[model samples]
Target chain A: MKLKDIIAALDAEVVSAEDLEKEISGGYCGDFLSFVMAQAPAGCAWFTVMSNHNVAAVAALTEVGVTILCEGVEPDEQLKAKAVGRGLDLIVTAKPVFEAVKALDL
Target chain B: MSSLHLEFDVAGNNFVSAGSASDEVKKTLKMLGVDPVAVRKVAIAMYEGEINMVIHAGGGKASVDIDTDKVKIVLADEGPGIPDISLAMKDGYSTAPDAIRDLGFGAGMGLPNMKKYTDEMHIDSTVGVGTTVTMVVNLR
Candidate 1:
């Protein structure tokens, strides 16, 4: 689904990169960087509650279409700017990580 | 043809920039028409190594050499080396401080995951000197 659709479906706010709405292949959720790196599928929307900047880095490296930041956690300003600079779609939701994933139908 | 070589300096202080090298390598592999699976494997493996460098080893340098049949990644770090490579290779043996964990890392899966995804893996480390990891993902 498009990133915009995911935002609407999950009731999330677009933290950055609103212009990019490329279709996502699937969803993968994890907090561990190594686990996500090894398991997360490319062209998918990665759901996590982690707000670190490396999350954006991993999304960029894995070519994930977007990142859904759950648990209502706001990323640092530097991270938000970095996500925008990297052309990564960052969405934040008030729901928990699992709820966001379920909302995406993953 | 000559091997396509690329190098990157991973900065320890910038967690956000850790995967830049891996991303660039992934793009290059894609453009080179490499197999998607192999590309993903290399990308993920190297990306994990890069993150480990930033999280545990202060910083490091990553060099990748791509050939027709395989991709070779050499990651060398000057930070404190692992005292026991075997223990560090375990899935849940992390020495990362709480700060690193707070950043969503330090779960101790980096080394194991890197080894799991690559076709061949080698590690050289000294307790106080440094560590070097060499990983290869063969494309057949």
Candidate 2:
């Protein structure tokens, strides 16, 4: 599914500039940065409450197309900037992580 | 030279920039045309080491070398050294406080994860001194 479609379906707010048309094959949810990096599938929508800068790095290394910060978590500006720097997109939502993951319908 | 060297000084107690070195390593590998899987292994190994340095060792230095068939990573820290390498390497062993866990790390997975992704891993530590981890990822 296209990331833009997932964003719209989840009502997530984009925090960084990037192409939303990118396709993501699956989803993985984990707050542990190392686990996410080592195990997450590429092009997956990463759902997590962890909005730290390292999240962006994990997304990049795992080649996840976008990060969905859940549970009303807002991306810190530094995190947004870093995500942008790495060619990754960040979005936030008031929805719980499970709810957001369901929205992707992957 | 069979290896190309890169260095980064990791700042301890700085959660904000924990993965900087690893990200740089990933970018470097991509630029140098390394295999995609090898790049992933090197990035994950170095990143876990960097986070350990920041969360437990109060910061450290990371040195990496890229070669035709292997990528080598060495991380050194001056924090209170590991008392037991065997215990530390256990998949679920970690000494990090709750605060570190709250950040989504320190789940006793760092060292094991590092070893999991690399082709070869070694650890050297001195009590009341520091620790050094050397890892290699082979491209072939």
lDDT of 2 by residue, A1-106 (tens): 8878888888878887478777878888888776787678777788899976767767776788778899989877778888777668888888998788766777
Please count the clashing residue pairs in each candidate, in the order shown.
Answer: 0, 2
The worst-scoring run of ten residues by lDDT in candidate 2 chain B lies at: B100-109
For A1-106, candidate 1 gives per-residue lDDT tens digits of 7777788998888888656556777888888776787678888888887887778777776767788888898988877988888778888999898778778754
| Model 2's interface RMSD | 1.7
**Candidate 2, clashing residue pairs?**
B12-B58, B12-B59
Which 10 successive residues of model 2 chain A have the least lDDT summed?
Answer: A52-61
Candidate 1 lDDT score relative to the true structure: 0.85
Off by over 4 Å in 1: A17-21
Docking class of 2: medium
Docking class of 1: medium
Against the correct fold, how does model 2 do in TM-score?
A: 0.93
